[model samples]
Target: MARGLSQPKRIVILGGGYVGLYAALGLQRKLKGNEASVTVIDPQPHMTYQPFLPEAAAGAIEPRHVVVPLRKTLKRCHVLTARVTKISHADKCVEIEAPDGHTEQVGFDILVVALGSVARLMPIPGLAEQGIAFKTIGEAIFLRNHVMSKLDAAASTVDQELRRKLLTFTFVGGGFAGIEALAELEDMARFATRYYENIEPSDLRWVLVEAAGRILPEVRESLGVYTVLQLEKRGIEVYLSTLAKSFENGHVILSDGTEFDSDTIVWTAGVKANPVLATSDLPLDERGRLKATPTLQVEGLPDVWTAGDNAAVPDLSRIEEDPSALCAPNAQHAVRQANQMAKNIVSVLRDKQPRDYFHKNVGSVASLGLHKGVADVYNVKAKGFIAWGMHRGYHVARVPTFNRKFRVVADWLLSGLLRREVISMGQINNPRAEFDRVSRS
Candidate 1:
């Protein structure tokens, strides 16, 4: 909390992602001097708009523009570049561990638990040491570089078996993340094949494995069926109701008794709320998400609110008819919930009545590539090129700051008029390459 503020309530926001940044920005705009002091605690100093991740992976946009600087944008809020190792809701304080390995306890009048989800993982044999996840910017860039490097390896290799494995890409999970990534990377690889004299489009193989009966379960089944067909039409294999039982020794084994050898494995299986939720004594739901009320507040806790993928906010809109339709963890709900959470905080401070959190599902849009997409917008379904355009348009408008919005738009415009660059700066993967060369003396 900042100094020279007497009796001013301190609002502590956890997580600097979409939810945290938006809520803090709204609170700063809604509250005045001495009204309340906002402090945002997060491990990263910036917030990433994840919707643009596929484009970044496809090399359509610059990676740096995808993240918004929390300190620069949320100037009014105190930005602590530290991880919230533990939270003490009962005592109205949180314990944050700094980058240099120091711990400190910070008190708060209002606690906002928005420590969003992390890539849900299991103790699958060899997965921990081999699989790569698509969650952070660093991971996105790594995957991009890794994919291009594999293409280079395949083109230069003389062994047929080695070339097949190097060019083969396997993605586990059929959700939005997996499908979009497969689509974008497939598009990129197909485009990149033109530059490789020895590598053709048919040389690369793309496979998607899903444990569920369908992909994009958030959309209607009809659309899911269409998505499978569309992917199949483009030579992408989709395996339904199957899980990667194990990837031990580079052998991909599915529950359906299928096995394949591939050099690249991308895991987008699912996400669970941050394990930090367990570090605190907060009330959690069956799936380990914080149990939050319709108003986005903790069920029995005062001045403590939760949102994003980490909080299980009840879907009263659908709870009566369908017991299983809780708010699907997506960006749409996060944005609306953050706005309402900010207003609720301001309302509590001013002794005003807090409003209930109610939002109609506005539908979803996903891009397969530059000209391929699937969307069900407000009950109107669209596919192919039009849907792809809508997907990019929706995300460009929703990507936070205008600076990022413009850059993303420019990238799209340039890509349409020019050839996609398939160059890989592999040196990014090894920062010490130059130092090592200099030290060889």
Candidate 2:
């Protein structure tokens, strides 16, 4: 029922993630009262702020507070709750499939390929069947419930082997997700053991396996060493320079010939660009990420732009003279890039000059658990409770939307008044509740 020019400039944004949300909102603000139409297509209607995921898992914050609904945030844009199946850049059309199995093609004047990264799974046998990833809200909630369920199972069981296996938690990878998740969950489990009749915190075995020699590589080497020592102090086993060959049939085989039985194996090794990139004819880097300049424009595609984990934007700040020195795939870079991309899009629309992206590293922070963390802010190393407080303060300010921020703050306050609930709701994992139903006769 709306009429405009015969054809208006259509800005199509894929994925409602960190980069996509920021870019869409920024565009909506910049293009106010313009004829340009911005349509954002993502499988989910919300954008998740992943920095708070560890706290959510540790029951320090509610899961819903960590995600911002895109429709509410981007009211001026058309929000499509659908998964992008394919893109024909040559034809300037995209194929989208909705939740109801309906498919449609949408035309675009300018395309923003922000289809973000997915769990970078390997060809290791049995990983698909036994491992869990930490990318989605569902995964975070399910992991929290699953971890608590393991604790309950361990405490209630009399079988020593089963108890040991239930208490044995293995996290594969050394990145922020892996390290933070391991630290938070281990702390939660340790705190929960006080309620168990027969279980002790010492009975639990927390193992971190990283293929690389160190963890939290984004931080300085000294900080990484400090992280290892802090985790070790809490009885966590750090297996560096190791790889998980397979987790087939509940038996975990490591490259170092070490084997373990664990009921929980969380794989946070790394993330690769979404496979959706292959469907498009756009230029991609060796890692399959869209080739993009610091200006956030895709190569050979004037009207198309890409950023976030899917785009390999050049690091203008890094004057190493190496072509391989691209921007790091992180929230910090994604946010700054999205803002710059939005500005460039508007500049081009208004026939103005756009600017490039160049920002110095602000440093990193990792929360180990309640009152325990590590941070390197402005080259100043901080650890213990002070770092933990800074971690909470930093993320609380970064969480998008007032609703989410208030909810997260409320969760933190309520947590102080109430004991951490360790119960598990495992039934939601399967939708078909009666799938196993059978006749007794």
Best by TM-score: 1
Candidate 2 lDDT over 42-66, as tens digits, reads 9999999998888888888888888
Each model's lDDT comes to: 0.89, 0.89
Backbone clashes in model 1, listed as residue pairs = none
- Work out how many backbone clashes candidate 1 has: 0
Error of 1 at 146 (Å): 0.5
TM-scores for every candidate against the unseen true structure: 0.96, 0.96
Clash total of candidate 2: 0
**Residue range 82-196, candidate 1, lDDT tens digits:** 9998888887789999999999999988899999999988777878877989988888899999999999888887999889889889998898998998899899999999999
Residue 213 of model 2 has an lDDT of 95
